[model samples]
Target: MRNVAVVAFPGVQSLDVSGPLDVFAEANRFLLPDEHYRLEVVGLEHGPLRCSNGMTNFADRHFSEVQDGYDLLLVAGGPGLVHQEFADEIYAWRT
Candidate 1:
């Protein structure tokens, strides 16, 4: 099974993460039930991630704690995405 890591950060757009998550969930339910991907929500820190609209999202793991073994790492985009720091962090994690 492929391990998928999704980065959830402050000010991230909900749909950016939810859309792909739903698609992956559905694909796992039907197409790849036997050998599907494992999804994990990772944050910069071990706490709640506040969205742009004030929605709070919890993370399963922290970015610093993440080790090797992930097949995919997705970083959601939003209005706050203009900040390059988050992009740099994501790229660092991906590499």
Candidate 2:
């Protein structure tokens, strides 16, 4: 199985995160159980994430909680994303 991590933050564009994930999930339905993509929502911190559209989402795991590496990583973007600040480690993790 492929471990897929979708990174999201406050003010994130919902589609930027959900679109790709939904595609992966839909693809899983046609594949065997063992070949399924394991999708996980990863947040910078724990608790609820309030998006730009005011939708609330809960992350499956926080950055600190992620110990294993993912086969695929997706970062959600939005207008507010440019205004937000994050730790250097978060950027380093992507590399």
Candidate 3:
């Protein structure tokens, strides 16, 4: 199985996160029986993230704990991404 990580944060656009996910889910249906995407929700911190629409969802892992190996990494964007808070920290982490 290929690992797929979706990076999410507070005020994230719900569709930005869920849209690609829907495609991934659909792809799995057509793949060979031995292949499938293992989707993981990763967040800046451990716990649930609040969406721009006021909905909350939990992540499977924290960004800090992520290691070097991942088939794909998707970053979800929102209005909150314009803020300076956590920017430096996240940039450093990505490097």
Candidate 4:
């Protein structure tokens, strides 16, 4: 199974994260039901991630703690995208 990690941070745009997640989920549902991508919503730190609109999302794991075998890493963008801290973090793992 493919391990996919979706990176979530404060002020991240919902669509940026949800769009690919929806597509991946649907594709996995039809194309690889028996063995498919394992999706993980990860945060930079271990806590709730507040969106640009103020909605909070609890993450499954911290970015530092994520296992090393992921097949894909998705970085969500929004107002937070301009932050240098987030950029550094994303660049560190983007391949």
Candidate 5:
């Protein structure tokens, strides 16, 4: 199975975290039993996270604590990012 990590934060748009993941999850229904994606929500910190829409969700793992490499890493985007910059480690990871 491929490791898919969706990076989210305090004010992410609910859709950004849920939408594509829904698609990936649905895709698994038609794929081979062993050939599937393992989706996880990664946060800067591991614990409860509050979203822009007033919804709360738990992160599967803390970003800094993610030692295993993910096959796919998707970062959620939203209005809350208007004044925030991606952490330096994020850029390093991308590079």
Candidate 6:
């Protein structure tokens, strides 16, 4: 299976993370088991992330915990994202 990680943080736009993931999930149903995507929501810290719309999303993994490189990495964005600061480790994981 292909590993897909969606990076999320506080005040993230919910759609930015969920929209594309939903599409991939739906497509998985039509693919073979080995070709399916294994989706994971990664966060700065492990726990809950509050979105711009007040929705809570649980992090399947945290930046510090992620070791394996994913087939796809999606960075979720929001109005507040640009104004926030992240640790060097988080950026390193992305690269």
Please give the RMSD to the true structure for each candidate, in Å. Answer: 2.4, 1.4, 1.8, 2.5, 1.9, 1.3
lDDT of 4: 0.76
For residue 80, model 1's alpha carbon misses the true position, in angstroms, by 1.1
Taking all chains together, each candidate's TM-score versus the true structure is: 0.82, 0.91, 0.86, 0.80, 0.87, 0.91
- Stretches off by above 4 angstroms in model 3 are none
Worst 10 residues of 5 by lDDT: 86-95
Which of the two candidates, 3 or 5, achieves a greater TM-score against the reference? 5
Q: How displaced is residue 54 in candidate 4, in Å?
A: 1.8
Q: Mind giving the per-residue lDDT tens digits that candidate 4 earns over 43-91? A: 8766888888777877788877765767888878888577636446645
Ten-residue region with minimum lDDT total, candidate 6: 86-95
Worst 10 residues of 4 by lDDT: 86-95
What's model 3's lDDT at 38? 85
Winner on TM-score between 3 and 6 is 6
lDDT of 6: 0.88
| Per-residue accuracy of model 2 over 10-47 as CA lDDT, tens digit each | 88888888898999999999999999999999998679
lDDT computed for candidate 1: 0.78
- Where is model 1 poorest over a 10-residue stretch in terms of lDDT? 86-95
Global lDDT of each candidate: 0.78, 0.87, 0.83, 0.76, 0.84, 0.88
Which residue runs does candidate 2 get wrong by more than 4 Å?
none
Q: What's model 6's lDDT at 72? A: 89
lDDT per residue for candidate 6 within 1-95, as digits (tens), equals 99988889989999999998999999999999999999989888668999999999888977788778889888889999878998787766652
Clashes of 6: 0
Worst 10 residues of 2 by lDDT: 86-95
Expressed as tens digits, the lDDT of each residue in 1-95 for candidate 1 is: 87887778888888877777888888888655658978888886568988887888888888877777688888788797787364466566642
Residues 1-95, model 3: lDDT tens digits: 89888899888888888898889999999998569998888887668889898888788888888776679989899887887377566778761
Better of 2 and 5 by lDDT: 2
Q: For candidate 2, what is the lDDT?
A: 0.87
